[model samples]
Target: MHVRFTLQIFAVALLVSTTAARAGILRVYPGESIQAAIDAANPGDTILVEPGEYYEDAGSIYGLRITTDNLRLIGKSKNSHSHPSDKAGQMSNRVRLIANGAQETGVYVAPAGCEYKNSACAEELQGFYLRGFSVEGYPANGIQTRWVNGFQFVRNVSVNNLNNGIYPTLSANGLVRDNISYGSLDTAMWVAGSENIRVIGNELFGSVIGFEITVSNQVQASHNKIYDNTVGIGLFHPNGAGNPPLPVMENWVIEHNHIYDNNRPNDAPDGSFQADLPPGTGVLLMGVSNHVVGKNRVANNGFVGIGILGWCSATTGTDNSCETRPPISDPAANDNQISLNTLNGNGESPPGGILDFLAADLVYFQLEVTVGAGNCFKNNKPEGLTFVSSAPNGELPSDNC
Candidate 1:
């Protein structure tokens, strides 16, 4: 029976590869719409679009209304396709795709519109590969996915956009690698409520929300070169009615990243929009738990480096008090481990430090210290670390730093 199960798994993997390879070779023309080809594509098929301009109306090309899984969208040009020589010591060709229409998102992954009900979306899609494509000029997001699994985005690029370069919502087990994401007023990438996801070996520059991960669980973000972003890496929660409160977001690992020179001035007319500042910081963890942020080189942030701010909000509570103090604090945001990070010339602009831990409202504890509050930290090396507590004692000594 064990052997049988193993064989079954192998067979499934083989089927996946077979379908993927078949899908990889199908060529799409200039006159034919990319969406139509994707709609006709079967699972495990590759759709190759030649080098040319393709016009699309709002919404996604593949699996726009219906949820289609296991599809690979690639390019046919040397610039769009993988470079011929692996070790050529040369810049590989880049695929340039121009979007000429208004849409909610450039390339999105979700169930069909028919699946939209009440306030929830269909969650039956998984395993989409979007490569060698350039997406631009979207009304909302560049790429949006929700409730899917096993997505691979490689060697694709986006520019001159309005929203996020890539937005994946409520997904599990995906990868964003070797891509260039830029020229957006909004986030470069925004991921929420995801698990087992990775953002590695990508270049993100010039965006409102660069590398924003909020309300997520069990994610790993590392080894990517992030620069010139307003909020290099952001983690937060959205306010609304009947919103699912954040549960314990656990087992998140952030390591080996080069985050530098992120402090860009906020372009939003309203000062309340804080997502667009290019402050130099590696990781910002709020409303999250069981996270590990280490081995990163962070520098030149306008504000504090590696900030940990715990705030609360209530759905059903006294008027506007929930904005300041929710009836319940997110239990998950507590308890984290941060260590082994290199900080250089950080906090040049304002209240800055290599590390800053700001917590409030739980009146029992004193200030200036972080320990024994159901959270733990050890072996942290920040050039200038500061621990700020609003509680009574309100401050951990420099030793804790």
Candidate 2:
């Protein structure tokens, strides 16, 4: 009996070792192909890439496409002292994935067999983590993900990418934190058609729009520094072409961010919709409701600090080519709250289009034909608040529920 029991224990140990070997780390050194190792890895395996400049011209659409689920692509450092916080050392020790202006995207995470419209589809693909890389010079986006769930994109740098720097579309329950992105032709970081996303502790600059949340729900964006863009932060509805089918942009909380000095000219590609954004606007809310903008330092922007305009008002009188199709049903900016923010030295100079409109610290363009309901601004100090509107309304209500 004692011999039989020992044999059973040994067989169990062998089974455990076999299972561990199946999910092993595949390491790729310099001069080796990173894509080969990724193609060889199973789900739940890690692809560890060594420090080198990898110029794999694999994707004209996207350089590296990750279709498998639960895969981790980590950058392995040879220098023991290199840390992600030390910019110079981190850049030296990073696996630099460069598109060299040839590929459209540096890294594209495309999980299979999922549809974002179904709430239960998030369970189809799980556990994707990308960390510690310098991804740059792509025409479309640095790192983009679609139809992914429970993803983590942290401690990465994206620069000089077109369209967007880090874009996550049709994803759910993701965390995008501790990243630095700049010099994109469009928005630096855009979360579109996603749900339950947390964009925190990131810095974005030198893009047409620093950060944008469009057609997404249950988003919380806080503790970010946004500057040197055409528009610092934008919350927009889905009214234009190529927009998602979602009708409402609601339940968003944008708080405690430093949004200032957005004086850069809009350099987005010609005929793009973002090229219509006025330079030096700090924050723009176009036809989005049930959102909160609180406890932010919005200063030194040339145009209005925060502008709430209807969808038709924003898109109307511009080039007819920049029009939203199917005409939004509810075009009024309603039921939004802007409170407890430090707004100072804003609207120093008005733009050409809004020259006749009052350049105040906060301006709400109330439509003459249809009045929106439950739109209020209060609990902000320093008195002397101004309003720009067709009708003179006194005493905004204090309820910001």
Q: Per-residue error at 267 for model 1, in Å?
A: 2.2
How many clashing pairs does model 1 include? Answer: 23
Deviation of model 1 at 154, angstroms: 1.4
lDDT of 2 by residue, 73-189 (tens): 987666647544355765577888878435678888765544322344444466688887778788778888777888988878887888789888777899999888899988899
Point out the worst 10-residue segment of candidate 1 by lDDT: 359-368
How many angstroms is residue 333 displaced in model 2 relative to the true structure, after the best TM-score fit? 1.3
Task: Give candidate 1 regions above 4 Å deviation.
Answer: 1-24, 58-66, 79-95, 114-118, 238-243, 269-282, 312-333, 351-377, 382-401
* lDDT (10s digit) by residue, model 1, range 1-401: 99999999999999978755665446787666777778788877788887666666444342233267777888655532443222121123433344554445667776666221124764568688888776666656676677778888887776655666777677788898887777677677766767778888877777755677766777787887777776677665443111254565566777888777776655532423343233444456554555677788777665545655443311112232345444243422455566677766555554242222221111112221233344444445553454444334554312223
Best by TM-score: 2
Clashing pairs in 2: none
Error of 1 at 16 (Å): 8.1
